[model samples]
Target: MSEIHGSYDMGPSVLSPENVAPKTAEVQDLERILRGEISAVEAYKQVLEKYSTYENANSLRRILVEHEKAVDFWKKQLRSQESFVEESSGPWGTVVETFVGAAKLFGDGPTLRALKEGEEHGLNEYQDLIENGNVNFESESFIKTICLDQQRLHIATLDSLIMMNKV
Candidate 1:
């Protein structure tokens, strides 16, 4: 075998080891958000099933669809980056489930209020991510779009709560 020559100068590193740590952290953050969306979807379904005959049941179903869409979008984004999306929502999910269970005891109005609060919490998380300025351009764009959708969902939930109060 021939002896090696001078040190090979590789071109610029696209994803150097130093660059990876921040990216990995960002991915983990996104995965956390994705898990939250998954829990939200499940929570909405549980509420829908619990109050199938409630006057605003159909509206709840529509909101569930929106949450499902958010889940799908997050999944697509994570997959695009070859990131592993966490399947479970972790401890916070358990807390959400417990809260939802308690809210059910109070009937449809309380359930809707709980859901509205959840959406607001999710919106705040996204906003925080955007404010942190650590995400890549693609992730930033996706988060902004998600934030807008979440804002709409929050408003819709508020409207539903108002109407429920009227009834």
Candidate 2:
């Protein structure tokens, strides 16, 4: 009901940095996962472009869309609480970009494997977030359902794609 700035203020406040809710480990982890989703979208786009002619392009694109949705969900949460959304994917994103870029040289097999690896990393991250008992993030159901489902689906899809390519 309130304006974005009226309800949430991410700017430097009169209070010290430590007092900010956004600095909490849970928010930090949420932002990290959000950034990872952004990075996943980027990687998917790159791999999709490289393999546009492949028969399973739509499946790959579906996974990309799922990642994008996760990014949007996190961004909305940050907007409500943290009052800021990350534009860049941050440190791990840089690593993903570099890994995918290099994998392109080796062709479809490596690229698909690279994408699967990324999904595995994401799955592990989500699990870690849920396992952190110190912070019982309310959206754990969403993490388990949508987030984990998409990651596992991507992994399985990529696995099938990888095996298909081998033939």
Best prediction by lDDT: 2
Query: Per-residue lDDT tens digits of candidate 1, residues 1-167?
Result: 89998999776555443433345667777877888888788888888777778676776777778778878877777767766556667788888898988988987667777787888888888888888876788778877776667656666766666576621
Alpha-carbon lDDT, every model: 0.74, 0.82
Count backbone clashes in candidate 1.
0
Give, for candidate 2, the lowest lDDT window spanning 10 residues: 13-22
Judged by lDDT against the true structure, how good is candidate 1?
0.74
**On residues 32-117, what C-alpha lDDT tens digit does candidate 2 reach at each position?**
88889999999998887787777788888889889998888887776666445677798988899999999998988998899999
Q: Whole-model lDDT for model 2 versus the true structure?
A: 0.82
Give candidate 2's total backbone clashes.
Answer: 0
**Whose TM-score is greatest here?**
2
State TM-scores per candidate: 0.76, 0.83
